[model samples]
Target: MIIITAILQMLRNGFVLSKTVIFIWGLVLSHALVSNGVVDVFADFLGDEKYNLWKAIMVKSFLEGLSAVLKVAVIHVSEAYIGRFKAIIFCTGSFTMGLVLLWIRASHLDIVTLIFAIVLIALGTAGKEPTLRDFFDYQLREKVKKNCTEKNEGEDKEPSQEKERSGKNDSAATNLWWSTASIIGSVIASFFLSSDHWGENFEISSIVMGATCLLFIIGIFCYYPEEKPSESPLTIPYRVFKAAIKNRRLSYPSSKQDYNNEDSDDASSEDFFYRTENGEVHLLPRHPSFSLFLDRAAMMNNSDDEEKVRKEEVCTVVQVRDVKNFCLIIPLVVTLFSYNLVSTSGNTYFVLQASTLSSYNIGAFDVSIMALFAIKSLITFVVRTIQSRYKVVRPLWSIAVGMFFSVLCCIAAWQVERRRLYLKKPDDDIPMSIMILTPQYFLLGLMEGFAEGGLKNFLSDRLYSESMKNFVEPYIEMLLGIGKFSSILFALVFYKWIKDEINHSRLDNYFLVLASLSFVYLGIYIFYAKFKFQRRRVAVPAETIQETIERMDELLQVEVDINQ
Candidate 1:
């Protein structure tokens, strides 16, 4: 309800509200549907076999990479569209294809069927999605601009003297109305999608979704004006509308009643900073937002000059030469130890150990331990909620805590492995009790909740610069994809090295590797603290070339201060 109200106010302020809402809705739905679909498909392919951790990880990574490729391809193709509605349709169709692939996998469909489906989906996505949307937006923007100018001219209003146009007008109340309707439609669609019954009703849900999509797209095309003024673009008004809707300029008391509800407060804030650009120095307000105005192409033109500075900095690499040299040695040891611990960790052996204890029949998704893993994910979700609600745990601190928990989880798994080893005294006898391994899997989920979650937040916060914050989510996801790729490569190498060894029950050896890696990482972190890391690097103005050179030289000469 609050989101709905806030969205309404945003639209009233004249912003392009539908696209943003759609993007968010699309991201959530796409992720959920794709995640479930892929998991279902992969479980079918793998069956209930007790493969090594490496093989499981490999299949997961490969599927993830394939998903990434599909996503990227869809995005590129969608960009060519002039009509946004056309693009949306294109994207929806493309992503649906990916979803279908998973469905086929889950159904244990033939390889030929899967191949044929993929080829068709790929072709549809690559050929159609991009161009339609690009064409739509281009035409829509051009028309809207012309209409706005004509409307102003009829009223004999003076043209805006502002040099820039920001896309805020698209967020105005009317625009919000469109978006609100879209959100409603999306929410409705989510309900049907979420339901378990698919007997004949599945087609109905698909029809509803298709109809809603068409309605929204057609509404945009028919409602928006056909021509725009060449003299006055829609940019400035859009910019103004954006600022007003975002509530970028105001501060309110934390008490709920301090302002007349969130919407009123937002409206008040919008009034304060509408159409304003540039921030005053040394005036940091409680809530602040900045817009990126500079063009990236302009920045790229200066990259040649940027490389020279990097080269000179490399020369000064010798200043801390002794320190970095010493630091480099630790990661190798840490890498080995961390790998060792993880190998024997509960997650690594959970599957093999769990199957023998009882007849844990596979779920509809074909997963052997659905109920257990789902509960773990739920616990992690609760932990995440608690962490978010209470600001007690800082991002980096959460990361540190997660790492601690991960180590503990690994150690606990080591204990289980040892117990299992002891119980199987010489005559191939395995422990039938699964309860022993339960805590290890539980801890793995907890560790994931803390460490991986924290790492994700930290990386996103640190690497997403002001200009590229919008792209940060995708970029980080791409990095995650890269990490998975690396993990796959690492597993392949490990398999090659150990495949020849006899009885190779090197499980203990693997556990040791991870534990040692963690310690090694800790040491390297200390070294980073002692030498390489810097807390606050305030840029000193260097107006002249000589001054700039000296400044660079000074930075090179000084050892990096770890503590800010």
Candidate 2:
């Protein structure tokens, strides 16, 4: 449906560069090839009869979690030091290098290649991913903004309908390409991993990655619009923390001089608001308690040192407010763990369960158990089309829908595992068909389609400003890592349930406990969503009062559209 929309929109509104679709295809391919490909890769270790099976699976989770941790550091360097474009170049280069190493690992099958390849692939893609997603929207927005400005300056005073149309088309086109890649990649990987030709799959993956990277780089110069990176939002917190430490002994200043100008932040507003990367001026919800302490970090000091006076000008006011909001947003970001946990299980335990099931051959091709993840992706192919038509009205609601799907997946898995165990004879192989796991995989695909995107929207779309989100974006990505790592801990705590053979382990019990935990997590999420974040009108920054007023209506409309 989304693909159809893109074609029709292109036909009606004319067209864009063919390379635009190609560029989007390359980006989506980079994302898709590894979206959950590692599960199969780890399953290969078990199939090869190499290391201990369960440990190999845990290693995969650990490496993924570690890569997620590295994502934060890499993004920090990208956003804070090198420009995002350059960071992507460096990261993509790393990712490509990882792919080459992964190909070598596939060919040789050794510990050295194995460890280095997975880490670099995981690390490089982790850095590229969140930035790539953000950059995609960022460049499109800048292009549309420039077009509108140019058109408005002319006599007609109309917006650039072409650029606006292009934005809509690009959004649809990207979704279409991403779904196409997921389906093709999943099917191809599943087919290849089932046989001795799995190494060829890696070889093919590496080659495609190289070409895509080249196209992505070329498109940047010739096709995509150029926009300079904003000053990193992260600098604010660094300065605030540094100042807080220096002024540690100082009491929370209560004087009027300590506060920012009322006009800068609309101090009279009942509550505070934040926004996306290119968002309106925002004020964070203030806490009378710790906020006063953060205030000292920005407030004028008693000492009239020349350096202090100069630094205070840049660091006070907006910086502290953003930092306070950062503090407030942390808990919400942490609340995202349940979805991450469910997602990790999709890649880890689901693959394990599928590996243990009986395989049915289709004509000449033997579709392996690992292809179950592909089934999940195939479901995603359908879900993305449906999702485009009816977006969730609120960020919280999107999250709720996603989490609900995840909980259902857990329940379904619990039932399936119990059934598989029940029918198994004491001394014979389990006779369950791979098709038996289809429902749970479908549930997982639904969870993947909605939950992750919903979580991202809450942060990068509505809850953060351009400067503010840079601080939290990587951490939010960390939820993926945290979930994977926690799986290791969960395995340790419930060691009896994770073993070389699913039939031996109490996996049904494990899934049931997981379902119960998910229910609790969902309850917690609902509790926080009810009281934690609220929308209210906010004031512009001290520096942009006039420009902000001109943009306020547009900003409000953006917020309204996001909610409904």
Candidate 3:
């Protein structure tokens, strides 16, 4: 009830409840339905005698994560050209085809067929589910801008604060629904999945997916404006890098006036400062020591007086700032891999280990162990509740907190797995209580709430550009995909550690390795947060490189002192 109230309150504060948002929410339900329902049950359904963890679980997981990384290309390259609607349609087709392939696999029980199906579904969900939600936010903002402008024009009235769109609140509300649907999907899947009922699970997932797709189609036709291929934001980084390389020798002008004069067009050159979503203008640093090559692109004056550089070879001051920030963000994305890599690998292993335990019951019927995977979503829902109640918005620090917990979760898994293995020496089935896994799931839930929710807040709060914000979300998913891709590498690297039977496999060692690397990456995050990200970045007055560095250090010292 509190969650529902939060949703209504958020919508009341200038949310447009657009068709695109509904479509995205539906996509989330469809994906969640299959993931917790079908993926983990593969070995059991296909007969554990024939399939093992390597084939049934790890193989499917690998391709799914790999597909997520691959979706970056599909989203930017293909979606950039064919229009978002067509790209969405193509992804929807893949999702439907995957379910059809799953139905076929049920009969033949082919590994190749199952893998192909998993890839298709992963590509569809990864490419669309998150992407659509972001698009909804973008579209919502655009609509708000339009409506506000029209009202102002008509009445000569100033747009109120309530009329201004709040992306953070709106995004939180969207996440609330998405998380709830995910939990429900997991529970629904449990009822539909047993060894004999696995076929029914896929069949139901296909129907749900199809129904959602139909709804999205109807919504698009009813509400979508005519599609136009906008200039891809992906090209911004390329242009900045290209211009930086071409004009590396050139130095920036002494005055803001000269910078303004260097503008290729009045539109790009309009300001040295960029406006945030809340109407605060942050003036970018004029001459920062870091990435000085980027500063050169802002200088329009050629060293050779008679020589002329092409238009494509130069960008405005604001573009240079945007590009430099983009570069800084890419390295930090590696540290984010710490959590995703651990979760992607640990989740399937958790389910397999759960099956080995004596089944727990609720009254008459036994509960599906896979339903435990829903705990993360449940925690996320709790985070949403706290956020809605308190209006919390600590974006970057929340992410760090999430990463910290993720390392602990990996450690917890390692200890529990080691203990489980120790007790399994005499009997393959140790009759261990399922309660042993509860703490791991509990920690995972905290990680999900902070890490995932924090990422959402970070995007809505820190990022200044709408175009960049939209692209960054997909980029983050790609990072997660890379994390997923690395899981395959880990399994191969520790091949002997993973056996056909859970009892024989030394997975505790595997968890240990993941925890160690995640700990190292967590250290990187702390170092970067303290020294790099927290520092007074390239967003200040025109100053000499030395003065800029000193100022940044001084400001960083203040921040550190405050933290202490």
Question: Top TM-score: which candidate number?
Answer: 3
lDDT of 3: 0.65
> Against the correct fold, how does model 2 do in TM-score?
0.75
Which ranking of candidates, highest TM-score first? 3, 2, 1
365-420 in candidate 3: lDDT tens per residue? 56666656666557766774565355464666777777888888889999999888
**Per-residue lDDT over 1-564 for candidate 1, one digit per residue giving the tens place of the 0 to 100 score:** 543454455545544434534433333333233222223223223323334445555554554444445544444433222333444566556545544453535335454554454443433333221233333344435444665665566575545621112234432433333334434433333333322222222234333334444554555534443332221112222333343344333442222222212113244232221122243111111111222211111111123524633432111111112122222223322322342234223322454445434332234332233334444555565455455435346655564565566666666755766666566645455644655665766776676666545544543443212222222333333344444455555545556433321123544444445555665665554454334222311122225446757888878667455333
**Residues forming the 10-long window of minimal summed lDDT in candidate 3:** 274-283
- Model 2 lDDT per residue over 1-564, tens place: 665764465345333234455674575565566554543455544445445646666777777787788887776776667766677777777777876776666646677777777777776677555676666645544554555566566566445565565566555544444456667666656655443455655666667677777887777764454455545656667887778777767654444455344325455342223222233222344532355466556555565744675655425555666677556545755776666667777666776666666787788776565566677776665554445455534556667777788889999999998888888888737788878878888898887667655555555553324567544557666756776777767777788777666667888888898888888888888787775554322333545555666688889999999999
The TM-score between candidate 1 and the true structure equals 0.46
How high is the CA lDDT of each candidate model? 0.40, 0.63, 0.65
Among all candidates shown, the one with the greatest lDDT: 3
TM-score of each: 0.46, 0.75, 0.77
What's the true lDDT of residue 546 in model 1? 60
Query: Worst 10-residue stretch by lDDT in candidate 1?
Result: 292-301
lDDT of 2: 0.63
Task: Please give the RMSD of candidate 3 to the true structure.
Answer: 8.1
